[model samples]
Target: MLRSCCFRCFGRRNGDGLLWHMDLKPHASGDFSIAVVQANSSLEDQSQVFTSPSATYVGVYDGHGGPEASRFVNRHLFPYLHKFSKEQGGLSPDVIKKAFNATEEDFTRLVKRSMPVKPQIASVGSCCLVGAISDGELYVANLGDSRAVLGRRGFDGEKSLVAERLSTDHNVSCENVRKEVEALHPDDSHIVVYCRGVWRIKGIIQVSRSIGDVYLKKPEFHRDPVFQQYGNFVPMKRPVLTAEPSIVTRKLIPQDLFLIFASDGLWEHLSDEAAVQIVSKYPRAGIAKRLVAAALQEAAKKREVRYKDIKKIERGIRRHFHDDITVVVIYLDHHKSSSKPNHKQGTAGCITPPVDIFSYNSDEAVENSGDKIFPNEESRSRVAY
Candidate 1:
């Protein structure tokens, strides 16, 4: 049972305030499972989970900004998803989309309430990429640039990777983003010039979509007002205020082998085929840790960090890496049997209501069981071994 593999490796760098963490907890009925991975940057790449009984196989979250945002999401987001699913009935793509939006709203509200006086903290935000598997179906939701790619084993004994982008970036360079920004700052040519060519809003921020950044969602700033006048009502712009992720769903065929969820930091340095090749060579858990180690090693090598300079070693490591790197490799094995009836060979099943594996009373049993499963720092520190 893979049960989900999550490890956070920090590079030796100044201002490397990235965080990566994950959690995998069995459902109340002990039949299904949920997993989450959060990372602040590419250097702090995260990993996914593959559990047994094969109920609900995978769920992942890739985070950006500083470590706080990623850490906060890693701790809070999955719980909200569970709660939302319980209330909404099952984990359809629609249910997952609703949960993602609600979670982001709640997270933003919570951050605003907690940091009422600190305006700087309001600017801090992170990108999110999520994937959820329920009742043999896969649902993906994304915010920012982190990606989820599925690799399926083919009949000819070959494997091909299929990438389905679930979220849209909020950067001003996007056509829709450009149109929106132009509406706001019609008079500001510099903003348009900076955003158009470099794909940055103010010449610094690369991503247009993310969590947090309440400050950027304000009116009288950007180009057009963040809040638009809707007749007698003023409505907040979708990109600025809403974290509702774009959702995509697909049936899980037996040939589906694995998935890779990684931040842009890692993807920027490595291609999709190269990344999948690295993970496909190993088993699930081993591949997860190896991917993190490989990213760190690559960052270190690129920065030219000298092995002899003990004092500057961390600095060297950090110099080569400005952002956190998180990678999650989810190994999907369909050979195992599930409680559901099998479809004919080569034919994937149609999307139907998700099967309920747990009854109402199962919640009480889950609570009473009191099984805790997350790695402590000491255990995670040994990742290099």
Candidate 2:
């Protein structure tokens, strides 16, 4: 049996700007399930939920620059992915790849039209990872560094985290990425200078694959200069840097445990294995909250702040850990119980109404939408007595 929960918590440093949300539901004759967790640096993260008798669609976009790009994908990606899938008549590997590429192009165009004032939103981009699971098949499309790792239960009943690496990191340091960068700066000794050889233009930005940031992709800006001093050397055209992402897919089995979709900040402090160990020990809904708490605690420890004064220690923590942190945990099994059931089913009755479960939305239609149906929301919101 397997059980799951979708829980999230935003640290104080992120202010009210951080947006985190998750949607999970059963699909394909209840043989498969779909879950999506999205987090952003601003409260502008948006998502669309579509439910079909046979499948559920979910996509997450972590926006940068401003919340608009993230919000745009959240609102549009799933619909487009579904359309692409339908056109292909199924969720084949080729369809998934085309959908990702098409979505990226669509997203780029939409953003440009939506925000005519490029400078106001200039340099803003986003890391997007889209996953569609249907009939034991999982299709993933990604841009930027936001990642998805699969966790599985071993023979011993212990969980193991395996990074299937659905997407490639788009930064400039990769051989292909370096070539792209060098194409732009052929005359420069350093191709996108950084702290050490360890950092290149590709690695420095951290997110190798992404949408937007037209400034970085401009040939004139990133291409190396072609020097022809004193008419001694022949002139040549330099190459330009690029930040294109890769698409990946795999067949899933019941043995596949869970997945962690998160930003680099949370991953910075923990490994996939460490994250699995921690979440496997607790219920799924509490995983994200606990992960955030752990990260804050780790940040606090680094600053030597007393537990009692953790609130007052924000400045110190921010100084050492500046990036906004976000985490989304998706458990594969839906039947596993984290604790014993209590007789009291709240003041209402044995059946917990959908409205009572997800109080986040006021609209009844929004609540009943199959995409927002999360069995763990109500139970996870309460503090264990």
Candidate 3:
């Protein structure tokens, strides 16, 4: 049923640019919508949604410096989650943490291995945010500033939904985050610095926790000749950024209407309440795309430009107005029967965008040139959704 539904409904691209969206699709607990708009020259943001009869996993990775780190996470994180969940017999906070750490370590090793040929991998990193639902329980794990927000009804018989943030932001812009970083390195007065009107760790990166950014985390990488070419390299006695995620777990109830998982691109322009209220008042179909449009509209308004004009600008130039945005809106359906198994039994069917959206414009083209476009078998299969 899930496969037939996906084949019939089909994911579609919007306009001529880098935007892609899936109107609506069924997951274990309910329905979900996904949308992504690329702004960077190479599309640094990567996202995926995996659904099955008993579980659903959502990931949004917002990359910086390069797309390699985010793409690596996209390729490795979920499998690691699945591997650990299977070995441990179930998903838990420890399982999720292990997945994150495993992915981070693997990426670090990749950077090390590729340094001889592609030394820039050391500078690439991404913010990872994951929302996983299993057996009526919800788990939110996050590193960096990407967010997951829960929309639920009020406790006193109220009809309106309340916005509750489920993940912690690790960006140094927050006072608490800066203090945490400073407290970790008391002797380094410049551990967190105010530069270019924003707080950054070592005046280099805003996120204090992430999967990569190996140059900031490894002293050996910091001393590498390749990293030194970036200018103003700050020496650190220890790793400044961490792969550890701030994890939160909760039991899903009927009152939990839906969840909005998005990158900082959407949050920078739209507030949590605004995003949740839009989903609450709008149609389920294309709600994720609608939220992205709302954020883009706000981004346009801030610059005194029309939304149409903003859409006209090419990828790299568009980054000046807004970063790459990825949104997944998961609606809870407590009344739905969970006993029915999915088409592949309990295995999740994955839905993900191509590594580079700018390269492919249509579903037909992507399907026709799957091997040329995706290159890797795992990548090709992942985008089949």
Candidate 4:
């Protein structure tokens, strides 16, 4: 019944920019479920999960500035992961690191190729978080603010679930991350700056590590036309930021009940403990959707608006409230023997298929008669939810 606990509402697909929460669906891992909710007019978050007999992989990619970096990672990261996975005859820490490095290296190549034609490409980047399970070990690697939290129960008559954060957040909002950036650039006192009540690198981007943002990582791209709002520009000899991910390895144990992997948007509204408690208390089926809904409600509360009113607002306009939220919850199977591996299931070599969750806003606009103008294609009459 846990796997069957999905939120269900029927609405056929359409070309409009709106997208409702996806109903929960299983991956190759029979125990896990994934769902996503898009809030941005142009969705910038991308995520995927793949399971094979030997391994399970989950990715949460959050794009900033634009969608190119996230989209590129969604298309290529897993393939590179699969390539190294097969080459090594299994998954390993080195393999995951290489996959990330290769993906970063490849995206830089893309930025170089496009910079001449589209100067804006230099600024786009994505925060990368990947979770891999193999050979009884769980490997979590992250480059940005996305997080992975484990819900664990004690085997020694413990009745409650405990939240264990697995991924390291690289956002400047964390004091340690700011220290890390400052350590990297000892000579540059202004490397990490505090501005508008938030810490940022050079008073610009918040995350200290990421996959793209060639403009910040590579000195050559900085001279090009950057976003005007992010002025006071200074060039550096070495990269201002990095693509290296902080990876942690743990032996997967039976006590581990489930894992919550989500973008920062969800965390902006919900804490790790709050999320784990929800999963522990609720049926597993549509929990990801539930988490997303919770985040939206929190966002609405902060804006002092009714949830129903927020729901009625269109995508582009919704940006002022919240961000694109993506969540994947994987419940570990207790019935299976913890000592054994799932080798018999075969290599889960297939990268989850790419999804076009983001739609560009069309130039055409709709006028609300005696009201505000909006997109006419957003026909509320046709959507059931």
List the global CA lDDT of all models: 0.47, 0.47, 0.84, 0.73
Residue 60's lDDT within candidate 1 is 39
The RMSD of every model to the true structure, in order and in angstroms, is: 11.1, 11.0, 4.8, 7.5
Give the per-residue Cα lDDT of candidate 3 at 267.
99
Q: Residue 138, candidate 4: how far off, in angstroms?
A: 0.8
Q: Enumerate residue pairs that collide in model 4.
A: 5-285, 5-286, 52-348
TM-score for each predicted model, relative to the true structure: 0.62, 0.63, 0.90, 0.83
Q: CA lDDT of 218 in candidate 2?
A: 40
Give stretches of model 4 more than 4 Å off.
Answer: 1-24, 27-29, 155-159, 225-233, 337-385
In model 1, the Cα lDDT at residue 299 comes to: 59
Q: What is the alpha-carbon lDDT of model 4 when measured against the actual structure?
A: 0.73
lDDT of 1 by residue, 138-204 (tens): 7777767777776665556454544434445555656787776667665655444464457665454
Query: What is model 1's C-alpha RMSD?
Result: 11.1
- Write one digit per residue (lDDT tens) for candidate 2, span 1-385: 0001112211122221122323223332222212222222122223232333444344445566655556445444555566676778887767656655665667556544534333334345667766655655666667766666777755464535444445555555456765655665667665455666555553335455665544455432222222111112222243223334566767766667766666555565666667667766875544565665666566557667753354333322342443455555555543322222233211111101122212233233433422331123343334221
Ranking by lDDT: 3, 4, 1, 2
Of 1 and 3, the candidate ahead on lDDT is 3
Best by the TM-score measure: 3
What is the alpha-carbon lDDT of model 1 when measured against the actual structure?
Answer: 0.47
Q: Tell me the TM-score of model 1.
A: 0.62
